[model samples]
Target chain A: MFFDEFKSWQKELTHYSFEQVSQGDVERALGHERLDFMDFLALLSPAAKLYLEPMAQKAHRLTLQNFGKSILLFTPLYLANFCSNQCVYCSYNIKNKILRRKLSLAEVEVEGKAIAEKGLQHLLLLTGESRQASSPEYIADCTRILRPYFASLGIEVYPLETQEYRELYAAGIDTLTIYQEVYDEDIYASVHLAGPKRIHRYRLEAPERACEAGFSGVTIGALLGLGEWRKEAFFTGLHASYLQKTYPDVEIVVSAPRMRPHAGSYKPQYPITDAELVQILLAYRLFMPRGGITLSTRESAPMRDALLPLGITKLSAGSLTSVGGYAESTETGSAQFEVSDERSVEEVVAMLRSKGYQPVFCDWVNLRDRRGA
Target chain B: MQQVNCELLNDPFEIGGQKLRSRLFTGTGKFSSHELVPQIIEASGTQVVTMALRRLDWRNPQENILNYIPKGITLLPNTSGARTAEEAIRIARLAKAAGCGNWIKIEVIQDQRYLLPDNPETLIAAEQLVKEGFVVLPYMSPDLGTARRLESVGAAAVMPLGAPIGSNRGLQTRELIRILIEEISLPIIVDAGIGRPSEAAEALEMGAAAVLVNTAIATADQPLEMAHAFRLAVEAGRSAYLAGLGARRDQAEASSPLTGFLREE
Candidate 1:
């Protein structure tokens, strides 16, 4: 029904004026009139490619204007490395020779404390797809222990059921990030040869499940190097739009984590250039200004820095790809993937400040405490 | 010389039935630390602060975000994470139990990309809460039509986004907000989408009763200083509006005697 409805809507939209939304109007919401869906499509066309630089400038100005010279920084903690899937491109594929490890409850706590001590209030928990090893119970347990330590808790592990997500949200999970890896279902299936991740539809709907389960925020992304970069970016934008329309209350965050150096022979089929990445980010900003665009530590520091003001908002700083990084007591020493920006949290904060962006540590204040009456 | 006092700058402003000595309504997300919040709020001369329920501990009173705020400041708990009427109501109940029942900043955002408030959910939540005797101030799009409906449904005030929340694009919806002010008798607070003091000033100049900002101030290099700037901007904008802006003309009209002065000289 939705597909049919969308098709009709698309047809009807073709008859409407799909004029370009000027960059100035887009950024400042000034003289440029409000755009219909068709106009938005035109604003993101190949013809729109020439206008990317200006769009980025407008996005930068708007970003600074709304968010000021500030950036939200966080770090990811890979709690478990065990995987049930045999993904071709991943370092943690089930058939890979790399050592697999999962942090015990105590180990996770140690890492959590180290992250907090390092001045990070937000943490993203990552785990490979292994229900037996890292069950819903295990993930929720980690969340419960870490809830008091951080202001924001995000999970980028295996996709779970709606009820499972609801439990996690109830356990104080603030954000749920699930990357589709690639939007092409054929490529998605071929890449994840085995395991639960082979199911493209399930992973595709993971974000929706999270939203349905009442998570505050859901992050969607595509691994850029997996398929045609432009096609994937376009699809990623479309996915964001769909989720935004379907679930209005949930915060939508879009991330683009291009394939970096990995152990597998599966090289990048299509490498997205830094400028192209900027174009994608700018397009997103022009199309959806308020959406949170995250830049992982996969990109170079300079690139991340340059992109930060363009359209990116939330970021991961001083992230560790291996389990028990914070504890510094890793039985399995090697990491899943190499980090590009290895700067410490303090250094990242200093950089942001040097760039004139205010680094906000905390802002949540309850009304009951404010008013005695 | 008249003794000019900037301390008078800290004087309170009343909107609806609530009295706010400080005009800033800080957002909870997109910051660096929770430890630095009270200090930043203190420095900003803010008496009213906003928080998202999802970001707080409602079940544990001590762990609740309410316990973290400094004394004498008013806490305006917002339904930030709620996506549906059911969720908003449930969160509102939890908030009430956690001690902020009478006042709620009802934000029912359906679009995560823009964080634009869902009019249907806002109306539903407001209606339900108003009957329950909750003082609901709904965050809405800059649509006067919706504001009137909310007002009719007994909303304390209508807060329309100047732009999308946290986009920092200021007064993007300036025209619509202007219409809201003209059409609605209730206080119109320009909430969200304000990126700088200038944007806040612009809103104030356009006759916004108050402006709610979080990202612009909290994300600044010095949040306290940014807060001060916003305070001044709000005052300036409000003062300018009250002073009466002259009508705009398509062509320039000379302030001085344009025709004869130069020629005669």
Candidate 2:
């Protein structure tokens, strides 16, 4: 598992500060030569700021080369907001006194149809970390209900056992998105006060377990602002690289979800600047040129548009964080976080088209469905 | 007009149903500018030219390398920098989807220091890609077993490296490549590390179906002249191979009259 490798990498990365990276390291990283893990550290160093123009140029060229002009569009269908964990930064914490909603099979169909009407073929089903409210069987049931409308299905919920992941895979869910939230052990414990989510090792191993269960792709993320932003970014990039090398057949994606204003009053310990976030994204691109990048609507419209050419391959459009927000936006308090980009699916598609970016709704096809045995 | 080589045209070089008139395949990397690609193609008269699938830009007219490549040339889109079989397959699919064609050169390199292709992953990718209807040409280390496996998996050609990529060392693995050509029934394409025209000729003279050259022609002082020189060399080598040469001998065999007038025998 990557958790074992992550511990040694954490030790390996302890002494280096973002300021310690030199100009020569940055120059070597920017050259035509292939980059390694150490070169990746240099690109993530603070000194890389001096060469941002060249870095951005390389990132853009690399993105255009690998992904072409296609920007895969997906929308999240928040099925439930009930949680048993008291994560400080989240709005769906169990301690929070709010009306929690869980979508029934009938309601999930409505949400699926609503997203399909927007012409989205990719759907990411999300829920708060509460097994009682949103079990693996329940998520699989929802996947089967939505499978007819969408070409691809993903889950961003509580981590499950390998067997449970296999169940979801059998139900046509090909992608898994789980956020480690924070990599720092002390900070991780401090934020995740209670529930299964507090088990740090389990969350860190979720992506690998899902890959073992035969999930086609897995998106792992470290929620920015909970821990030191630079260190979090470094670990996130390293984790993605680890998963890529370990499971060569499974696709890996990384996201930098910066802290956003939620229903809670918890303040971020360290806020990453826009420039710093740009550096992180550029570093991920240069390190893993062919890896997928998911830029969510947590960022504002202008920022999202600006970062598209920088190496983002996947974009969440017309996303509804509140439970059953697509069919009916009744549970206003149930939203996990506030989305800065409130554009409709058509508007987002049009924005991509205006920039000569092709919005790909579904890049993967299910061979089983194509040729039924 | 130049004299037509009717004898050379008698036996057409074909791969995956595409008949190529020239045995010299060229690459688009290591060039100082994108505009030079078409000029080299014109000078080399190569029927097949390769480009890294990543370097192809469709939206940006200025960055689009395909705009510079003239028509009537088969585009061999290689999966460069792909560290695994899956990554190479992804690039190959994307290349075909982007209208590059059915031709793909599978290069799965995990060895960072030497940039050597992983033969195991190359074979796996070549098998999967061939099943998906691609004319897969896998570039790999020269091993007789791996070459046979590639041929069995329906690869259009087996591309064995002469040396490390971009090393400018010529025919470092000549014996291994020769074994592959002699053993496998498929077309053997010698790819990478052929820095001189003579090296390209050497491979062809040894019965290689084709030679893919990049750094030699692209990085030369006069790229067009170098490409022209390679073109002539490849033709001469092919003609020489086809015409056949005299056998090797341990002792001095006389080509002239061994009479008492010429020698005291």
True contacts kept of each: 0.00, 0.00
Predicted model with the maximum lDDT:
2
Q: Backbone clashes in each candidate structure, one number apiece?
A: 16, 0
Q: Which stretches of candidate 2 lie over 4 Å from their true place?
A: A329-333, A369-373, B1-265
Clash pairs for candidate 2: none
Q: How well is each residue in A20-91 modelled by candidate 1, as lDDT tens digits?
A: 444432333211222234334554445555555556566676576566776777789898888899988888
- Cα displacement (Å) at residue A301, model 1: 1.0
In the range A1-373, model 2's lDDT, one tens digit per residue, is 7888789988887776778888977876777334667778888887887766567777777899899999999999899889999999999989998778888898888888988988899899998889999988899889888888888899999989999998888888999999999999899999999998989999999999999999999998889889987778788888998888667689999999999998788999988878778888888888889899999999999889888888999999998788887766434337888889999999999999999999999899754452111
TM-score of 1: 0.57
List, for all models, the DockQ compared with the true complex. 0.02, 0.01
